[model samples]
Target: MSSKMEKFSVLMSVYHSDNPHYLDVALHSIYDDQLVKPDQIIIVADGELLQTQNDIIGKFISHCPNGIAELLQLPYNVGLAAALNTGLEHCRNNLVARMDSDDISSPDRFQKQITFMSTHTEIDVCGSYIDEIDPVTETFISTRKVPLTHNEIIVFARKRSPFSHPSVVFRKNKVISVGGYPPFRKSQDFALWSKMIVNDAKFANISDVLLRMRTGNDMMARRGISHLKYEIKVLGYQRKIGFITTGQFIHVLAIRTFFRILPGNFKKVVYKIIRKCYG
Candidate 1:
């Protein structure tokens, strides 16, 4: 079916195990992302951790479309992939967009992304640029841009992930056909994109930045190391598709290192200048 004919579910996993205020902030961002009402927004919590999440669901339900927000507490900490799979199963939609419990998204995020998917038929998954937030100040943070086409992004595997996980809005059918996310692991988002790319799945990125990712304490905080690991692994996957000489791979690592030490505020200034000069 065409994306134009699709309804979407914004699936998020909650760990009442997590801090309360951050969760509230996340839901507010989700509601804000939907320019048009979504099919529903479902939250899943660990079963052993149900009561904890029940309190949270009760607190946030009124913030969304009537009958649009709901929660499920799983029997255990089945891992993020498993919890999300459970949410996907219950909330039927032609498209699925991943949302982290602590990030913020722009108000037109879904409207713009879904409309893009509707016209670009060949692309199976798409993502947009994001701003990395400073958790302490709750202020707007550094922006990161990604390449726009499959070929450009495949080359991106030579460095860090070219796309932001939370900024992705994708075709659900393609995800399931590619085997969804792996069970009990980190870099599940990276793995999903890699697997799809290896199988010739199409991709694209919007030129505009659409998400605000809070770092330092969020789930992706292990980025400094975990990303290095995922990059090496992604490089290996790309090599299986073609050739990546040892020299080129090392160069990629050097570039990644340069971006890593870059001061956040400095990077913000640099991006602002770029946006003004070119955008």
Candidate 2:
């Protein structure tokens, strides 16, 4: 490790349904493939995982240098937000990078983010664009980009998520100071961003893509009515926090609910159009 580089921890949460192969790929990308590796890798097992998943995790622990990998096992499954909060408490470094079990991070992802955070000490949270890929074939789909500067991100957060969750490296203390991730099962990242924004935490996103995110066909299916309910809760919280005005809240909620209720195929098309226009 370079003397100028500050040590950081990689935090990930895995559950029963996560694909073992995908988890293995994600692990290797952040460790073996990275130009700047993390000082510690904290994996929070959200629930009881399959034997195959455990085997994959064991192999990864063996591959890492001694004391680099730590596993925190949960007796039962909790949603992503709570699981991450648990993992956050275990992070040994003040700077922590968030990783998803099914994403492929670019080798230079950490190198670039660490360099940016080291120099831009004012930024508490930094994220980047992500390339969406087909989960089955790993084929390129499209890029999901976010705002690059603090002001732009604050404005962008009014309508959509200003940061890609898995592509972010954030200050641990800043996040905890804002009460960590909110309790929403969905749109928790959006809610967290709103909380941080209201708390005056600085944010930024790199203009370049730093990770390949797996988007399965069920992506649209996952955004059904239940998802919309949590989204509405998040929007309500945003309004309460003064992150968005009542008018903006109603307008965005109407648009989101309309798309959420659309037929699956039609919803996908609508998403593409929206992404092209705003993403």
Candidate 3:
């Protein structure tokens, strides 16, 4: 089915800390280059953005075809998970394509994902490989590949998140029925995927790069001790919810904690090596 016949909404969230210029590029990537454009783009402002950020979004909305962009503003910074939940609620379509505020979706990102979902009706959630890029220059640093089948995804989820969050297009109702993103600051995507797996949702990957994800020191910094605490909490919840066994949960928790404390520079190097091996 064409995208127009099988409609989907693009859901995104932004906050004060997000770069306005990157946001502009992200919006254009979605609105401009696509075989099939989104029926509606829902952007949830997690909190009050800077005047410049507001202006960037306002200008995009103004130029959008009528009723294409739906902007929802929150009174405070409620973090990504909560903000995304709000955006999900406002989505008018069953299939919602996830996008990050600063990441650029490939021109065929939506087209590919929607086409896959349309054919593989059993796949409740699907994503694709991504090109990790330098946030400032947008230079492709490396590719991140994910498992392509449901069983592989389930096993991979036991060790790491199987899908690139922003590269995914999932069923809104399936996600919501599993309680949506948990109220965590980081690893919210991992948490949600865990819940969905426990709920027996089918998963897959397209095996083609669909998004250019921006990465920088800021992202590595977010992997510090505090974030590790929340990740452990998420892992424990996963174990409790039976998505993972006690042994698998403990093993992953230990490895993740060790990496969390590594120097940001070293962690970046380690990440590159891993991506190369998996790429």
Give the candidate number with the greatest TM-score: 2
- Which segments of candidate 2 are over 4 A away from where they belong? 1-3, 216-218
Ranked by lDDT, the better of candidates 1 and 3 is 3
RMSD in order of candidates = 4.7, 1.9, 1.9
Q: Write the per-residue lDDT of candidate 3 for residues 1-279, one digit (tens) a residue.
A: 333346899999999999999999999998887778999999999989999999989998998899999789999999999999999999999999999989999998888889888877778999999998899999877788999999999988888899999999999999999999998887899999999988899999998998999985457655788788888888988998998899998899888888888988888787767677754
Candidate 3: residue 47 Cα off by (Å)? 1.1
Q: Which digits, one per residue and each the tens of the lDDT, describe model 2 over residues 88-204?
A: 999999999999999999999999999989888888999999998999788988888788999999988989999889999999999999999999888898899999998999999
The model with the greater TM-score, 1 or 3, is 3
For each candidate, the alpha-carbon lDDT, in order, equals 0.71, 0.91, 0.89
Stretches off by above 4 angstroms in model 3 are 1-5, 216-218
Report clashes for each candidate as comma-separated counts. 1, 0, 0
Candidates 2 and 3 compared by lDDT, better number: 2
Which stretches of candidate 1 lie above 4 Å from their native place?
Answer: 1-5, 50-53, 62-66, 216-279
lDDT of candidate 1 over 48-163, digit per residue (tens): 54454566678778766587888787877888878877787777776777788878888888888878877787878889988777776667645677888789988775544667
